[model samples]
Target: MGTLSGNLQRPVIAASAVCIASISSDFRDKFWPNKSSDTCSSLEQANSFSLPNSLNEPKSSWVSKISVSKLSNLSFVTRIRIPVPDINNLIPVSRSSSVSSFLYSSLTSSHALINAYQSAELVKAAKPASYTYDVSSTPSEVLYRWHLPDPKSIDVTGSSDCSSVKSRTVVVLLGWLGAKQKHLNRYAEWYTSRGYHAITFTFPMSKILSYQVGGKAEQDIQLLVNHLADWLEEDGKNLVFHTFSNTGWLTYGVILEKLQRSDSSLMGRIRGCIVDSAPVAAPDPQVWASGFSAAFLKKNSVATKGVTSEQSATIKEGNKTTVEAKPELTETALLVILKKFFEVVLNIPTVNRRLSDVLGLLTSQQPSCPQLYIYSSADRVIPAGSVESFIDGQRRNGREVRACNFISTPHVDHFRNDPKLYSSQLTQFLDYCVLTCCTSS
Candidate 1:
C-alpha cells in the first residue's frame, strides 16, 4: 500500500475512458491489509469501465483483462479528476506549457521515499574542494569532459616505452540511481589521476522507473552508447567500464545485447570492465524492496560499515518512543509490502525481460574482455554468492575474471571501507587490461 501511495503521489491524468485492470487478490491483501470494502468496490469499478476504441491502444499482457482508452499523447500530462475507490480524490497537478518535456519527463515521480536522495547527506560530504571538467549533453547522453595527464609528468628516460601514457583511454563510469555528481566524481578522479579520460553517467529515479514499467529506456540507452561509440572511434581510444549497482549492470547488459547481435566492430574497442556490487541474477524479493527503499530514503548513499547502527539512531529522531515506533511503521515493513506488488502483482512482461530471473543471458553474451567483479558479503543488495557464481561462469567460458571480496564492505562501499585494497586491486586490473586486452582484436 505504501508503495502504491508513493508512486501515485504525482499528478497523473486518467483518460476519459478509464478501465480498471485486474489486480491480484494477493496484491490487494498485501497493499491494503485492512481488507476494506471500499477498496474492493473501487477495484471493481476500475476494472469494469470500457471506452469506445479502447482496443486501439497497446495493452500490457498483465493488464489486458480490462480495456482503457488511450490518451492522445502519452507524454502530455495534465490535471484531471478521477474517483479513487477507498481513498480521497486525487488532486490534479498543474504545470506550465513553457516547461520543457524533458524536464517534466525526468521529474515526474513524486515519491518522497524514492526521491529522498535528491538531498542526500553523502553528496554534500563527498563534494571536492576543487575540480574541473567540461559537460555536454545530447537527447540521450550526458558527457563529462576529461583528459589524460601530461606525458612530461612521468619519467620515460629509463622506461622502455611511454606510449601508454601518451595514449588516451576512455573510462565510462555509470553511477547507481539517485547518485549525485559529487559522489561519482570521487570515483572518476581515480581514473583521471592516472592519465585516463573519465566520463560519468548517472541513472535518474525517473529513468529507472521507466525501466521498471518496461518503457523505451532501452532505445535511449542505445542512443547513449552510439554517442560514446562515435567519440571513441573518432579518437581511437580504448574503452573501460566502471559500473556501480544494478543500474549500471542493466545498462551494460543492453550494450552486450547489441554487441552480440550486431556486426559492429565497436565491440572490440571495449578492453575490460570492473563491475562493483551488481548484476544480481536473482534477488530476494523482500531484500530487493528494502534495498530500494533504503537507497531512496538515504538519497543513493552507498551503505557502509555502521550504516545499520546509524539508521537505528536516526529512526529515533521524532518524539515517538521506541515502542511507539513499531516495526510495522518502519521502512522494512513498507518495503516488504511493496515487494509483493512488484514481484507478484504488476509483473508486466517485456521482450528480453530477464532481469527478474538469472543474468545468464548477460554473462553468456558478455564480450571477451578482462572482467573484474568486486563485492562484499555484507551488501544487502547484491548477494556475494551471485557475484562468485558469475565469476566462476566467466572463468569456465575461458575469460579472465578477478574477484575482490571485502569481508565487511557494504554495497558500493568497498572503496570507502578499505581504500588501499580497493585502489591496489583496481589499478592492477587496469594495468593488466592495458597491457594485454586493449591491444587485442
Candidate 2:
C-alpha cells in the first residue's frame, strides 16, 4: 500500500469551461426545472467566445459554433462533467482570466475531496478479509485473526524515515488450551491500540489431545510459521510472543523448532516474549491433568475456581472476627480420572518421544530474546515453582528474564483479576524491548 503522503502528491485535473457549462445546465434542469432555458443558453454562448492573442485585441473575436461543439466532445470533459449541484453557482459566466482563476479554485476544492476518498480506501484496504474455519470438519485446522493498527493512530508526515511509518512490531497471542478467538480478542485489542499488529492463534481441544509428531496440527503450524517469516521478510517487522498456559507454551515451542529448522535468521527478529501462566518445562501427568480439567470443567473445576476472602473467613464468638488462611485445592474425582488417563497415555512410546522432543527444543533452542513470565502462586494448573525453575534455567542460559507472581490468581486469570497491574507489566516490558531494538539497530 502507498503511504498517505504519496497519495497526496497526485495531480488534480482542472475542469474546462465547456465541462462546467454542461454540468451547470444539467444540474439546473434537475433541481430548478421551472427556470427558463435562457440562462443556460447565455452561459454556453459566453464560454463559446475564443481568447485573443493579445489583451488589446477587439471584443468581436467570436469562435464558430462548431468549435464549441468540438470542445464539448473532448473525452475528459464528458468524464468530469458530473451533475455536481453544489458547484453550479461556482461556475463563472464571463470568459475572462476569471475563468482560469475559477478552474484553479474548483480544482483545489476537488483535490481535498479526492484525498479524503483515497484515505478511506487505504484504511479499508489495510483491513483483513473475513476468515471462517470449522474444526469439526477439519480437525487439523488452526484459526487466527490479524488486527492492524488504526490509521488514525499513526502520524502523517512527508519524512522518509522508516521509524516514522506504521509500527514494525507484531505481537502474537497464543491462547490457552480451551481458549477461543473471542477469549483472546481483548488481549489483541490491547496490543493493536498501541499501533502494533496483533495476531491471535488458538487450537481446538480435539486437535491438541490427538496431536501427532507429523500430524495435521503440525502442518497448520508450519504454514503459520512460514506466513510470519514471509511477513517479516516483506516489512522487516519484529515479533513478540505472548502465550497463555502450557498448551500455548508448547505451541510456541513447536513454532520455534520450525523456524530454527527452516530459516534460522527469522529467529533473530524476535524482540521479546511474555509467557502467562506457562512453561512447565517437562511433561508431567499431574500438570497435564490439571490443565485439561480446567479447560473441560471451566468455572466448576477445582483447579480453576478461585477462593475469595469471604469464603476463607470464619465467624468467632463475642462479635470478634478472625481471618482464616485459604485452604489448598482438593483433587476432584474428574481430576483423578484425568490424571490416571494421562499417566497411561503419556507413557506410550510414541507420545513420550514426541513430547520429549518438543520439550527439549523449548528448553534449549529458544531465541535469546528478553522474556517476561507472568504467573501466580495460586495457579493450580502450572505450579509457581515450576515456572520459577524454568525462569532460572533461562537466566543461566544468558537470556534476559523477568518474572511476576500474582500470588492469588487462578490459572490464566492473572489479567482478569488485576488488569491494571497486568497492563502495566506488559507496557513496561514492551517499551524496553522496543527501545533495545532501536538502540541495537
- Top candidate by lDDT: 2
Tens-place lDDT per residue, model 2, 1-441, is 013123323321122355455665664343233435332333223322223334333341222111322222223223343221122233333457744444444433332222222222223233321111111111122376556564444444424233332356778899999998889978987876666767788987656655666877788687568557655654456889999998889889889989989889889989889999988988899999888878877877766654464432322121112322332354477678888978877887777788889989878878888899998766778877899999999889888998887766788988888899999999888878755544355
Alpha carbon lDDT of each predicted model: 0.52, 0.64
Worst 10 residues of 2 by lDDT: 130-139
lDDT of model number 1: 0.52
Candidate 2: which stretches are off by over 4 Å? 1-142, 158-166, 307-331, 437-441
Clashing pairs in 1: 20-46, 20-47, 117-299
User: Model 1: C-alpha RMSD to truth?
Assistant: 17.9
- lDDT of model 2 at residue 48? 28
Compose the digit string of candidate 1's lDDT tens values, residues 120-153.
2111222211222322122232323243333333
**Ten contiguous residues minimizing lDDT sum, candidate 1:** 110-119
Q: lDDT at 305 for candidate 2?
A: 59
Q: Clashing residue pairs in candidate 2, if any?
A: none
User: What residue runs in model 1 are displaced by over 4 Å at the alpha carbon?
Assistant: 1-132, 136-166, 212-216, 234-236, 260-263, 299-329, 351-358, 436-441
